[model samples]
Target: MKLNTIAALMALAGICSVGVAAELAEDPEAIRLRIGTGDPVAGKAKSESELCQGCHGEEGVSNVVGVPNLAAQFAPYLIKQLSDFRTQSRRHRIMNAMAEGLSETDLPDIAAYFASRSRPKEDGAGGPDANAKDLFLYGDVERNLDACASCHESDARGRVSRGVAYPALAGQQSGYLRVQLLNWKAGIRNNSPQGVMNRVASQLTEAEISELANYLSGL
Candidate 1:
């Protein structure tokens, strides 16, 4: 990216109030998650009329235990998931029905509205146990497990990999995260980049899943 473009991205990051650093411009695989995103103002009105707020709170905080929070999540990721739901690729009945009625623009619009909010508050879990911390910060070499930060970042804010914006995991619902991890481990959910999630989750015991979820949700 040109210096001017990088500066402009920084300025837009401020306007969006997202936690993106201009250095991401230099990463071949990293693209700002909000680049060319939809208008949040329009999205708010759309989400309300479409009843999207019934489950995901008006502020994008999830009210249900298994549902994921969307506040300050990556817009690109939101768009991709919604697109998948529409195509039935991700396979959720309610999501598919809801997404089916949406026009093409509605996808990005809704994503923008949710992404416009700041991250949700901590889940009150405080911090991860030592085992979870170890797994996240430093993978077990004996197990050939890669550190969670290799993709999700140490802060769990996520990072762009191969132009894919890994969803932010910090402040995500523990139940939701656990279920996804379990699904990956069991090969029930198989959309992760390069099958990495499946490989990584397969290495985790159930206790480790709970431990990681508890720690990440607290962030």
Candidate 2:
């Protein structure tokens, strides 16, 4: 594992021992939840001044190996991620410090800034294990496994609802997605107010996760 990944895992394990509610202390400075009010122009300024380009690359395209590509990610999902990182609900040393310093008002701008960018193309085809592809695309009817396309859409464009939030998976870093799925399964990334992802992730095996991550990365 990469150094940052190791650090994130260790931090997550530590937080897990402390209990979820206790670990996720509410931030007094966190931005209020605005349903749809992000500003791409302001977000662009924030990204430049805040040094987001250093890690996420120019326009959030992210060339860094482990870092996620933020371009074209769902705005609500981005907002929640920033909020979670800032509030200590999601544990990452670098992200935590960066988020802690941001105003709640900055969240929407950052989300909008990144969302306005075009999505990066995948480097190659996913070419995951045959069985895994079958499971992700077709699912196991006998076992009641639902196709991932059902919720994420066939192209992984994602769906949004007032109560439930689904994130786009297209062109995401496979390694990042794989680790996230594993974390969700292990109950180490459970700061979400809703439990849908935790439940869904818990149902998947390690192999299934690898396969899905590989597939989604190429979407």
Candidate 3:
């Protein structure tokens, strides 16, 4: 067990290093290929026309239990996710259909519109768990897991600037987080920054994943 823990930690460290390198190595051309320059105006028009309002809400907040709130999400992150859905790198029946209908030019604009909005004011759904809180704020070094806040920010708002993007977890759907974590652990999702999430999820037990997801959804 100790050896497994050590190996997991080492693996996580390597993933972090690779992720940072990938961030730094990303170039303008790469960015253009992944997500073109976003125009908020164009995005708003597309959002309305695309019927994003029906589910994501008029301002990008989702009242549905499992639908993520997109307001204030990083534009680059949003674009990347949309791209993933389009290419089937990530798979969700609803999201795949929505992404397939989106033109390449529409990706950036829609992302921009959502990114321009503020996250809707909503409290987390349940009472806090000290164990989960501790894990999210301070990962178990013994197991080689990094704190969620190390990359996600203490508030879980995520970060995006200078060609780097991290997805915001604050006020996001717990169910969605749970599903994605499971996918990462199962190797069904490999599109995370430098496969860091794959490594992170692999180190987490099923109960730990549940605790983390529940804690994050209410943030």
Candidate 4:
């Protein structure tokens, strides 16, 4: 494992299931000093200076329907997305323009800042229905699919390992999730690690994607 990931895991050691990163978000400078990421404080300032909060909202949640919430997202995932944007591996006109201004130091710090925000509020749409739950918890074996939780963790709170972090899906915008899944299925988006999303999405029907998105958004 990378040294920074080790430190992060050590920080997580013995902590309750509530999560250690959530507590560290507010003032992560202390722990961040020893990590590959950056200071949340600086990230907050830079985010504002760059007007990130304008669309992403004050606390990393988005006001727009299709815009994804960034609150409490894993810094590693956020950093990777930004890096992808800068490299055009993940293409988005607005995101690409926005990412161009960030320095290398700014990337992780900004990611850390968003990671510091609290998780997005859950929609009161009730929990996932049977089909959605089954797909999320245990994907169809006959289809050779992996359960969503296998990578995203329970309730899609996200997962972390070694030096990688998967993004949290709970309380994310259903619209955004649906769009992304569709993009993956259509090969419009191919930036996922090891093409995992591409493969998973290819097997999903439109109805299944919608069901899955709705299921995760309320989580």
Top model number, lDDT: 4
TM-score of each: 0.83, 0.77, 0.77, 0.84
In candidate 3, list every pair of residues with a backbone clash: 43-109, 124-218
Structure candidate 2, residue pairs in collision: 31-104
Off by over 4 Å in 2: 1-35, 128-130
**111-182, model 2: which lDDT tens digit per residue?**
766765556556984765677667666777886777776666677766665644567787888888899989
Candidate 3 matches the true fold with a TM-score of 0.77
How far is 157's C-alpha from truth in model 4 (Å)?
0.8
* Each prediction's RMSD to truth: 4.7, 14.0, 13.5, 5.9
lDDT per prediction?
0.77, 0.69, 0.73, 0.78
Number of backbone collisions per candidate, in order? 0, 1, 2, 0
Candidate 3: segments with Cα more than 4 A from true spot: 1-37, 124-127
lDDT of 4 by residue, 53-153 (tens): 99898678898877889977888888899999999999999999999888998988777767766678656642748898899999999999999989988
Residue 183 error, candidate 1, Å: 0.9
Q: Which residue pairs collide, candidate 4?
A: none
- lDDT of each residue in 53-142, candidate 3, tens digit only: 789987788877778788767778998899999999988899999999999889888886676565544564634789988888899999
lDDT by residue (tens digit), candidate 1, 93-204: 7999999999998988788777756677564663748888889889889999999987788888776567787888889888888899999899988777778999999999
